[model samples]
Target: MSAFDVRDLLKAAGHPGQLKAADAVHYAPTTSAIPPAEVGAPRDHGGAVSPVVLAGSVRIADLVLVVILGFAIHHIQLADMVGLGWRYPAAILSVAVLAVALFQAFGSYRIAAFRSFLKPALRLTAAWSLTFLVVATVMVFAKVADHYSRIWLATFYGLGLAMLLLERFALLHFVTARMRRGQFDRRTAIVGGGPLAEELIRALEAESESGIRIVGVFDDRGDTRSSSVVAGYPKLGTVSDLVDYARSTRLDLVVFTLPIAAEDRLLQMLAKLWVLPIDIRLSAKATKLKLRPRAYSYLGSVPVLDVFDKPMADWDIVTKAIFDRVVGAAMLIVLAPVMLGLAIAVRVTSPGPILFRQKRHGFNNETIEVYKFRSMYADQSDFTASKQVTRGDPRVTPLGRFIRRTSLDELPQLFNVLKGELSLVGPRPHAVHAKTNTTLYDQVVDGYFARHKVKPGITGWAQVNGWRGETDTDEKIQRRVDHDLYYIENWSILFDVQIMLATPLSLVTTKNAY
Candidate 1:
């Protein structure tokens, strides 16, 4: 039968679609019991799942629910006691604030707490009860306990606990349903398909509750030494193939099973793998060497040595996003007049659109349209930027020359920041086909794609530190990459603010503005 006919017959027969030869070779379709590699015994990696998907939303919901419950109960029971004055509502707000603080302190909002319902439910209950006790004690100490009705206070405590418990139960149900569909689990892959990999897979499977779903294994060797299937999992491809696969997939973690003693092999693997934006860990269970307690992190009791971490992960990403939007919006407001004047100048000076939209590499090597005021004549503009703009270029208009020199042409990128395509501060996005000295960027630098681990920004450490503007030479691009890598390795809100403050000064210098 033809392939299409066979596929249709299989679908009609209620079987899954046939796997292609490539898919069959890479994926293990059958689930068979496999022996774990010889290693340490499994221990409790207790707590909620690591990398909760909706942590920020959950926290916000928790706070909102608490406030609603506090006000609802207060209105029902204590409205008449305070005579509709601001004092009672102010007191309720104080209680809500205390509840949120105690919830955070008790680790109620942690990833581990959200993995299971009972733990977080208990935690929420404790936090709420403690908040009530603390607030009641303060009220009594202040000699205002009589001002508040005892019935109202008692009702508030009981109702608050009930409401929090209900919220936790609902959240637990929602997360459980998502987990069953393999939604929240981290998409992980095992590096080095051998005995160590088999052991790691077995351990991860044993603690399936930990939210690590290993897709397959990857090994450089293809001979009988590196079998097509290790344990029950198939060897997807070589490490190089893993890089391409990672680019196409939403891969979260890569657990390397190579021994720590094999420094050369480990380094070789890392050099190729580091280009992708994923967490890379060394399997500690495979080695006999021991390190301090703090040196190890657990993947469900399977200890792994940290090598390279995906920069600005989880809450850091959330905080940076908030900072970008708040700051980006404020800057757009402050620079609107200047941007408007520039837009009018560009439109009148050049017979083209006021804004120049060019495709650039965004976070995780994805393509995004970046905005800037058109700085060159319509007919002469290099959309791909394959040819670098040089000093005294005839294509640059009178207005374009002025704006480009003063960095005013980049003001429209504040909207890109607000649109969430770029950040206020990060490694600047390069044109989709950007080249340095007639060579592609990745060909020039070893781990060039690593700079894309974070969102592209309007201003960056490289820009602020004199690495901005024309990347005419290979050394210039290399130095820019080095500065970007440095920024990624050591990033904080304070560091971003510092770079932002230094940006205007850098712009005024105009060292390489062409």
Candidate 2:
């Protein structure tokens, strides 16, 4: 934790003088606690699942069903009436796209709609019908109806509707089963235990379909001021304990029920809570400050100001996973011969294993074993990287010097990316004891652990921007952290592609690595 003032931020929000000089804020980043064996490990806690994932899966499933069934009906039932040409195939794809858009417009893909079949079934039917109507209109206007069969269109509509209904019913059953196992619930916690907390809890419970399960409440006050329990939920611990609990549990959203006017307390709380990779929101339901409708978002009708949103959520996660797996596999296959040659050269030249594994802090502070080709003498290898490798170090082997300088030793980590322990582009992970000037990296930089919010990568914005190499000075690490934070804040698939493409040019131009 590092102490600083957030007065500037508060002033920008039109609220100032909310804190005394003594109440300095601390931005926290802690050390990793897990071991090397759990590399790319899944979180131990289980139960709650992301609603966005469920909704996205259902939407994709709808598209596949409609496209597959449309082709099936055309081939098996309408081959005689409809000619085999691009017109019918084009129509099926257009209907699938249109149906999906209409369903989204009707709110049929919402999380609430997934938990039941009747509402989604009705919405699906209407959307499907409208899709056919719109497509027919377009065909008629384009004078392309003569090439299509009326019988094919009618049969496709009826079959698509029945198939969609059946899929919805199956999804309803699956959701019900998962809910019974507590998988659909969002494990939420309130960060205040006074009257505001009680009111917020009551309001949340009123919406039974929201799937938010309030695990407990946390407050800094003693039992004398804040009761042991509020609105049937216990005060688990103080605000500090909440941080530890969230790291170890499957906690989803943390809502602050303290008054919006309590700016000092809110700032102090956010300083500590912002490091965790979870959603942090400030309750605005009972606040007197009025803002435009766009400033506030709703969670079951209760307005909240989003303080921090968990990154790489929902479709972002899906997109990154697909990119990493597909691209990583292709790279591995393309580089197989080079990797094999390096492996054999290392074995013959040095008396050690070809690959070296070292534990580094991964996403959410989990310790993961990152792989690299052996680039040092077996007897002098640094497992923990406690001492920074300097220029002209004696531990480097003849072949090691070439590989280390060119970053060819890092090629083995393509395996880590494929295994899900690393991303193709993100903040680079550091050794557990990596430091600058005899001080740990986290101790030197405030909120340093924030970089672990996403998976560490084989290449990153910092490396491509000329920040790769030994961190013998404080300034080097600080610059790296600054660039890493920038990448996280402004991340996209295209941004990642840009970084990866520039990586080779960076390797050739930079000379700091030893």
Candidate 3:
């Protein structure tokens, strides 16, 4: 009955839920037929289903996948120089997965984000570098790091970059071709049915990316004042009819081409249409202040400031993913000897299984089993820690104390990297019940849910900077959360590299690494 969460409304309705019985919902194949919003922007009389947008997206994904996967195989073959007769496939697969991740993180597939290669290219380099550094640093710290060769790492990077460049070039050519034929168009409409809407529609019609197809305008004003044709787009219907047309068609954006100075009327319109799933944007040309320089992004050289961006919208995510897999797999192959040793030690020292696994909150608040060495006495390993580990804790085994301190106990979780529950670098995931000062971590931090916006890490920004181990105090966890938030907000490949480098120094000083 509800419109659902603003973020999930469109996405959820597409799912197989019997959400609103038969007449309550309307469906159309956007890939084939997109209804018009502006009178001037009509569907092709030629009856051709435009394939450019879909084709471009799919081709970009495929090309990146192949190149990234292929280069990873090459890297593994090089790592085979370390005599890994069996671990090679896993290592390569890890790289393949991370490469995909990096691509996703970087938003390589997003339409607006990828229009310029300059920013995205630099980001790709940063994301891949950080991923490699994180995996390699962890392996070296564990003391059995000689399983990989530098030559293969070099080869993989070189080949991967070459493929990336080639793929982007090919994509550019293809996208341009589609634009030429008007096959990849973002059909948009204005709601105000005013002079501003007409101007905004005209402004968008003049740009590339196949330019926007401006559908007819919508206004409730009587015909005498609000004419039939507004900015060359006919007044299709009233606001109610606009909603109906919206149900029957595919519209990428709905511009509220009204000035903020007209506060009362704008508020009324927003209340009426805010429930819809499409991007609701305000045309910002009339604003007095030049918002933050960075806040304004050009829509064909006309500056429109950002409001709600699609989360992990583009290339930034794509690149981060690439880093995760490539480095995650490398760690698994290089640290196998250490992990195998830890497994044996755990079995020898305790009655239960070798690995310690527990439910920890992961990306998007999903409950995930995080793997570690069974450090506590078998019958007493706390699924939710009743007490924090301290110096000379009796619940810890003799072996557990040493492995936990050296962090060798965490080696088996390199597979968690392979499993995709954890990233090579992120805010380390905490148990669902993890708390400080008798309060859950989430309750104490105002933006705690924001952390779940990203994948949790095995070793994170806080951990590497001496915030590891038990959270015995409120301030301790807050500081850690502060650092974690800092990492998330100001994330870059270089920052990740710095964290990886600092981890060793920080670990050796594990004064609090209970």
Candidate 4:
């Protein structure tokens, strides 16, 4: 037996095993370990899921269409009756709202509903019929039933239901086609390979309609214990390797198949995995240990224990994108003169490009070109930013000093925000090669990459709280990372506004600003 075999034995006995590459092959009772093959290639599915045409957006569109249809029907029927007052239009609006609300109450807009045509169609029929009944009752109670045309109301109801059903059918077709093309599926990875992993894989594969495409399996155990193939899925790599893979790919979820009773093993895995900006769930079906009902969350009908959630997900991401564009555009327009004046000053005062584009770690550790007004002499500019700029740095120009102090240099990044490369408020993007105390920022902080789970921003909690400017020491970067993680965890639109509102005051004080 090898060192890895001994390690695995120790790990099974509840000791935290060292995660490393091992060549030994060991067998479990039901599933035997196979020799490791080459890591599986990433599956290619054409195009990402369309952000604009999601189920929620489609539901809202359905509501708007219903209101529009109602208005059209009312206009056609009541055209002959002059000065009928706002009663008819108001009734139409109320009925439309109530219809959409009923649809929501009946869960007509759920993903499962979109997966099949008949389910949503039936729900839509029921919801619309209920809405019409409620509206009729309200009209009767108000003694206004006689004021509206009965034939017109009946015709509108039939037309509205027909239109909604047609819409639902169209959406169903679209979603079905997208799923077949692998565009609408969630990319998932199993965190361990064993009997439990095989069982989970079987369960997931059995429900192909669930839209979870398991990318592959990842295990820290060597071939001795963990199989190279678990239920036909290739073991991708170790948990550390999984982190890098997830960071590079569009992995939506990481499912842990390790037993919940194995607290030490689970915690060790989570310590490495939580840095990722993906949903982490412990597969409850793999273990017999059951928790309270509230402790469990479901993915379809499968119960799993929620661990860490990807920050700024789904609607929150959409909301933040819209907020960034609107506010970023407004800020650009409002600060146009200041930016214009600064641009001219930089051009005349120094011989360099007006805007400096430097590579920074973006949303997923991807290198993105972050824009800034040139604040250093062109000849002396450090594109890599390996050397930290200090107070009264000789490389800075006269104009650069003033602009850097006042943070006018960062004004050009509003365009980056407009371009969707940055957020209005998030963890500030660090230069790709930025370092502190002769070491990379990631080296100083344990879960440093976790901050990059969300998009980098122009001004963040760290910047507003005086974590900006030169990060010369390990403590400074650590503090900044701590604040960034805090912002990510507690992010809300109001919190962003609060940070943005306080930014100017923070800039004015300029404690660490060079």
lDDT of 3 by residue, 1-514 (tens): 1222322443433434322211111233212112342323332221222344343455456545655554555556753445446544454555556755676677755554345567767776776666566656755896535665566656666676766666666666766666665445555667776567767777787775544667667675667877777766667765555554554444455666666786555544443443333445677764666687677666666566543332332355556667778888887888888788878888987889888888887765567898898998998798885567888999999999998897777776777877777877788888878877577775565345446546788777898878898788878887887777667666776776788678778779878776
Q: Mind giving the per-residue lDDT tens digits that candidate 2 earns over 1-514?
A: 1112232454555544433211221324222322233222225432356688888887888888888888888889777766668887898899988999999998888878888777778888898999999999999999988788888899999888888888888888888888887777777889987788888899889988777888888888877998978998777777766676666566678999888778777776775676667788888865877888898988878778887887667678778989998999999999999999999999999998899999998887778999999999999999989788888999989899899888999999999999899998999989988989698887666567777778899999999999998998878998898788778778899999999999999999888998
Give per-residue CA lDDT, model 1, range 240-339, as digits (tens). 6676666555677899988878765665566566656678888887788888878899887778888767776667877898999999999999989988
RMSD (Å) of each candidate, 1 decimal: 11.8, 5.2, 17.6, 6.5
Off by over 4 Å in 1: 1-76, 79-148, 173-183
Worst 10 residues of 1 by lDDT: 38-47
Residue-level lDDT of model 4, residues 117-151, one tens digit each, is 87668888999999999999988999989888898
lDDT: which candidate is best? 2
Cα deviation of 107, candidate 1, in Å = 7.7
Candidate lDDT scores, in order, read: 0.76, 0.80, 0.63, 0.79
Candidates' TM-scores?
0.81, 0.87, 0.50, 0.87
**Per model, how many backbone clashes are there?**
1, 0, 32, 2
What is the Cα-based lDDT of residue 103 in candidate 1? 85
Instruction: Give the Cα error of residue 442 in candidate 3, in Å.
Output: 1.5
Models sorted by lDDT, best on top: 2, 4, 1, 3
